[model samples]
Target: MRLIIAGLFALAVMLSPAAYAVQPDEIMADPVKEARARDLSRELRCMVCQNQSIDDSEAPLARDLRLLVRERIAAGDSDSQVIDFLVARYGEFVLLKPRFERQTWLLWLLTPLALAGGGLALWMHGRRRPKSAPGEDGSEAILSAAEEARLQRLMAAEPPPESPS
Candidate 1:
């Protein structure tokens, strides 16, 4: 049915990868340079949309960044040079994935360090736990003499329940 076809089309659009936000006017005439610009845009963050790559962000700042990338590429700057220029201009926050450096060592190492610390603490906790000896019912808890006597007395004092007539 037409309804089902329309629904399928809608679902396909929704499931597809996000469309790039670059406008027609922003595209460079040279395909090679444009492609390079696009690749660089995808690596740079949209300052306005902090989590989104400039290539995928529709923000005015993202558009400017895309244009800047194209301008840099046209000026014969290499990818790394363009990236370094942007970093110098906007700080490291402009990069979608920051490079590992002495300044960023803590940011890059914190997660693995925390995970290792947690694993070590869990291992120590497991080792420190007293192990129960296996018995007929799986684990035997050894009761003290007074506790055993108390249990015996309590069991002996409990009356047997009468069976239902």
Candidate 2:
């Protein structure tokens, strides 16, 4: 059926690896430099697209970033130097994976800290909960001895039910 074929095509597109955005004109004559450029491009974020790397985005800003990386490579800048230049220009946000330093310590540790807090809360909640009696199916009201006595008194005050002959 047409629907089945369309679904299969959609699935194939989704399962495919990320597409490369580097055009033919952007490739360098030297394979080594080109490889380095590609590696750096993969590490750089596409400012316009926000989610994809420069190497995998089709946005104009991503294209510019790709070209800039190639230019730095051609100019004999070391990988570290190129990365430093980008960091200086775009701040640390340009890096896909930020360094674990004092400035970013909260970002790195927030999840674990929250998870530990949640676990402690759950444990404390369980500890403080009232224990249900055996065979109590959780639907009946749980009452203390004094409250049960009061309920019995109230029931005795009511008239007895009349039975049909």
Please tell me which predicted candidate would have the highest TM-score against the true structure.
1
Using lDDT as the measure, which candidate wins? 1
Per-residue accuracy of model 2 over 55-105 as CA lDDT, tens digit each: 988887888898999999999999999999999999999999887989999
Q: Write the per-residue lDDT of candidate 1 for residues 1-90, one digit (tens) a residue.
A: 999999999988766534548888999999989889988998999999999999988898998999889888989999999999999999
Stretch of 10 with least lDDT, candidate 2: 12-21
**Candidate 1 — which residues are off by over 4 angstroms?**
1-20, 136-165
Off by over 4 Å in 2: 1-20, 134-165
Query: Each model's TM-score, in the order given?
Result: 0.75, 0.68
